[model samples]
Target: MNITFQKNAVTLLGTPLKEGEKMPDFTVCDNSLQEVKGGDLSGVRIFAVVPSLDTGVCDLEIKRFNEKASQYPDVKLYAVSLDLPFAQARWCGANGVNAVTTLSDYRERDFGRVTGTLIQELSLLTRAIFLVDDDNVVRYVEYVPEITDHPDYDTLEQKLNQVIRAQ
Candidate 1:
């Protein structure tokens, strides 16, 4: 699906992940620059995709998730972005963000291309969220229609609650 950035139409590369489909395989870098693959993560996971950590919208998204994460200890929160691992680490440290782990898609657009969150024009990820259950099936997917807008946190929280209850 096409989305807008700063109110201008922009293309998102690859097919967006759909609910009930098996989560696609992809790799992202951690703060330490180690490769993290989707297949390696188990249990309920939330991929909080974003463009850059430095941006206000992305910063708020990650901070919100980090704060919300304490309420759902069982769910693993991942903030995926195109920012460098070092930058992510710095942001986390400066902001006291520990509950949510940050993953960088810089080395390769592996996660970006597969999740279809990669913005073709900017080569950055579009804001989106995905809930993957323990079985690796996608339970929820949300792609912000506007790049600058915040996600529907209410709906996302509701879905997460349902997933936790089932777990």
Candidate 2:
């Protein structure tokens, strides 16, 4: 998908993953520099992809998800960025973003490339949201057309509620 980065048209590295697609095998570094394999994660997951935590919009997106995630205690919320692991840890600690686990794609951009969130021009992940179920199938996806815009939080909530209702 093509996203406007500060109004400049830039396309993603690959076709974005759509709902119903299985999670691709990928690895990302946690805040502690631990390797996390995407396939190993089992349960409802909400992945919030951002460019960097230092940016105002990325900061707010993760913070808002971290704050609201408490209501859905069973769901795993993750914030992925291209920043280094130490920086992610520092940002999470400073912002008190405990509810969301931060992951870094600095080394290989494994997760970003597999998920098609990597921006071709900037080599950064664009703003997006992916909701994956226990079986590892993507149930909801929101690839924000613009990097500066926020994803539809209410629609995401409704999708989560739908998952709850299904159970």
Candidate 3:
């Protein structure tokens, strides 16, 4: 898909995910450098994919999610990126972000390829958010048309509430 990054457009590599589809399983390194399989994560998960943690917007985005993470202790929130595990760890430590988990896809880029957030030219993941239920079924997906734009927070909160109410 064609997604813009501050007016510059780029194409994503794989097919985009849709709601109700099974979440694709992939391997990524955690902040501790431990390999984790997406399928191994149980319960509701919110995956926030970003290009790089060094960027201002991406940094703020992750921090924002981290701030909100405590509201839903049962849910797993992940900040996915192509940054090295060491960098992810450093960033988390420097920012005092302890709630949301950070995963690095630098080695295989599996998370980016599976989620169709891989930006071909940039070799970075495009900005996107996905909410997957306990059954591994995707409950919501937002592929931000503009890579620099933030996902709809209001809708995300509302949808999360709806899911919580249904459970």
The candidate scoring highest on TM-score is 1
Comparing 1 with 2 on TM-score, the higher-scoring candidate is: 1
Estimate candidate 1's RMSD in Å: 0.7
Ranking by TM-score: 1, 2, 3
Cα TM-score of candidate 2 = 0.97
Candidate 3 lDDT over residue span 77-103, tens digit each: 999999999999999999999998999
Error of 1 at 13 (Å): 0.8
Candidate 2 collision pairs: none
Deviation in angstroms for 128 in model 3? 0.2
Instruction: Give lDDT per model, in order.
Output: 0.93, 0.90, 0.90
How well does model 2 score by local distance difference test? 0.90
Question: Which residues of candidate 2, in runs, are more than 4 Å off?
Answer: none
- In model 3, what lDDT does residue 11 have? 86
- Candidate 1's TM-score: 0.98
| Model 1 C-alpha lDDT per residue in residues 1-167, reported as the tens digit of each score | 76999899999998899999999999889999898988999999999999999999999989999999879998999999999999999999999999999999999898989989989899999999999998999999999999999999999999988988887
Higher TM-score: candidate 1 or 3?
1
Off by over 4 Å in 3: none
Q: Which candidate tops lDDT?
A: 1
